[model samples]
Target: MVAVDDMNRRILNLLKADGKLTYREIAAKLRRSPSTVRDRIRRMEDYNVILGYAAIVDREITGMKADAIVLADVEDGVSVRDLRKLNGVDGVAEVSAVSGDRRVIIRLRAHDSETLDTIISNKLIPAGLKDVEVRIIMEEIMRFPGTS
Candidate 1:
């Protein structure tokens, strides 16, 4: 990880929700000069401290109407990539190999439960699905990627 100074940390905090912040805005927030803020931001970008900026659209409001957390145990022969590339897989949030009982835990989301089930039943578990569990979230209590 890149080491960030207090001013840079403050700069990132200011830009997390609004990526289009002018250098002047960030400088004002950190109580620094605009040129200093610009240089730091440029260094951050060059070093990958700041990746690309994006607007986060709410999936539920935008007709990504449903989502499910499919937890499963695969056989020893399977791999994380094998479970990751499934139909209706919006994104493979994380795939980690387990310790005691199962092979891996996969987090995938989709537009609906039927799609989610099909992905799990057909692809993910076929590797050696010892067991499976599903959770359909009714509401998102915590917000996305809040301040660190």
Candidate 2:
């Protein structure tokens, strides 16, 4: 395992809060040399501790008006790799094999309620998901790494 020291944790926190922060900017905040900060970040990236950065987009602005969390039971003999196929399906955001009564969980988004229902009834059901429970996301209280 990669041993992340206190300094590295601080650097990670800064980067998580603002991925666009330059090494010099992070160094200034952490009171460390820019090169030192740069090296630590590079090491973390190489170890896959620090994955790629991306923009936190507003779903509404992108015409996505509906969001839902779908919990379902995976069919017999179906693998998590099989569930991964949903990743390419429209309105499917994230698919996870979680520890719960509903082992397979999916994060979905769509243009409206009708579309959301269609995705669940058509795509998800046809894909071998059973006993599906979809909970509409009324509000997102907090988004990790950064607030939405």
Candidate 3:
């Protein structure tokens, strides 16, 4: 495990809230110098404690009006690539082979519910996915660290 010190944790927390915060701003909040903040962040990156950064956009504004988490009991013969390449799949945010009744879980985005339905019916069903459970995402409460 990466041994993150208290100061580094504070830096991470600040960055989690707002990745755009400059090193100077983070230093001011943490009562540290910009050089110190920069060095620590660089060190964290080197240690793989910090992976990368991204921007969080409003899906609706980006023409994605619907999001769903789909859990499927995929048979052993099913191809993940086929599942991933489905039409109208705006984004496959996550796909996991998990230990449960459901073998795969996928996070997807679409322009609307009708499109989502079409994708599920035409693509997912035909791809050999069964016992599918889809949950619509209404709100995002929190995001990953160092992301908007």
Candidate 4:
């Protein structure tokens, strides 16, 4: 395993903030040589520490005006593999299993409230999610890195 020392951690933090930064830019910020930064990044990539990169788009511009968090209980006999299948559903951004009264949580996005309702009713419910509770996201105060 590659040691994620202080330098590597700093490099990761810089990349997390802006994945488009070049090795030279990162090197300048961390006061390290570009070759050193490049080598560290390459090592991390080889070990799968850096899974991939993606564009963070504006939801409004993409016509995804509505966003909601759906918390529900998985019906008896539903397999973990089946739960993972929810990720394939349109507008289902995230699907997670947590320990709570409601074990399954899903992040959904759609064009409007009606469309969001349709996804829950037609898609999620039919797939075996029950006792569903949806909380619509009013505004995004902050977003984590690497998520659109």
Candidate 5:
């Protein structure tokens, strides 16, 4: 595992809060040199600990009025990549292939529940997914790599 020190954790926390923060800005907040912060960030990236940045937008404000957690029972020949390309699939946040009743879990967004239903009943069924169970996401309580 990649060893992350307290400084590294602090840097990650800062980035998580606002990814657009410049290296100099982060350095100022952490009371460190810009080069030091840069080096640490580079090392984290090298270790694959620091993934790319994303803009966390409010779905309601973006017209994505609906979101769902879809548990798909994929057949033997089904591909996860194919599922990701389906229409109205704003994001394929998670796809886990495990030994269980459901093969994959996917998070997706659409303009409304009707659109989501159409995407599932029309698109997913024909794409070799044997069965699907969908649950609307009410709220996002927590996300990964949390600051605490």
Candidate 6:
């Protein structure tokens, strides 16, 4: 991880609040010159510290209510190694090996229950997944890395 100074932290925090916030606004908040702020932001971008930015939209406002994160316990003796090979599994959010309950906690988003089932029964299972457990999210609690 790159070491960031107080100014860098301040800049990042400000950006986190509103990535669209202007450099002048950021400078005003950090009590630095706008040019300095701009340069710092550029340097951060070059260093890949500032990865990217996105807009946050409320799902309810967008009529996307069927969203959920499905966690499956692969049955059919499908090894964790093979489950990772599934086509629909984009970016393994987390993988944990446990004794009792969930062997692999895969995070996935779907538009509706049908899509969710298709993703699980069609794609994942056919890819060698057997035993599976699913947890449909009724609400989206949080999303992090702030899209960056």
- Best-fitting candidate, scored by TM-score: 4
Q: Taking the tens digit of each residue's C-alpha lDDT, what string does model 4 give over 1-148?
A: 7898999989888888899999999999999899999999999999988888878889999999999999998788985458776767889988888888998889999999999999999999888889999999999999998567
Candidate 1 per-residue lDDT over residues 14-91, each given as its tens digit: 888678889998887778899998988889999999987877667777666566565667666766556545534444
Error of 6 at 57 (Å): 2.0
Write down the TM-score for model 1.
0.70
**Local accuracy of candidate 6 as per-residue lDDT tens digits, 1-148:** 4558988998998888788889999998888899999999999998899988878766566554455444556666667676656543632234455565656666655456776677767666676554677777777567774541
Question: Which segments of model 1 are wrong by more than 4 Å?
Answer: 79-105, 126-130, 145-148
The pairs that clash in candidate 2 are: none
lDDT of 2 by residue, 82-126 (tens): 887787899998888988888888999999999999999989988
Overall lDDT per candidate, in order of appearance? 0.70, 0.88, 0.81, 0.90, 0.78, 0.69
Clashing pairs in 4: none
Please write out the lDDT profile of model 3 over residues 52-78, one tens digit for every residue: 876878777889878888899875787
- Candidate 5 per-residue C-alpha lDDT over 20-45 given as tens digits, one digit per residue, 9 for 90 to 100: 88999999999999999999999999
Question: Estimated TM-score per prediction?
Answer: 0.70, 0.88, 0.74, 0.89, 0.74, 0.68
Give the lDDT ranking, best first.
4, 2, 3, 5, 1, 6
> What stretches of model 2 exceed 4 Å from their correct place?
none
Ranking by TM-score: 4, 2, 5, 3, 1, 6
Q: Give the TM-score comparing model 3 with the true structure, all chains together.
A: 0.74
Model 5 whole-model lDDT (C-alpha atoms)? 0.78
Evaluation by TM-score, superior candidate among 3 and 6: 3
The local lDDT score (0 to 100) that residue 104 gets in candidate 6 is 64
Q: Using alpha carbons, what is the TM-score of model 5?
A: 0.74
The better-scoring model by TM-score among 1 and 4 is 4
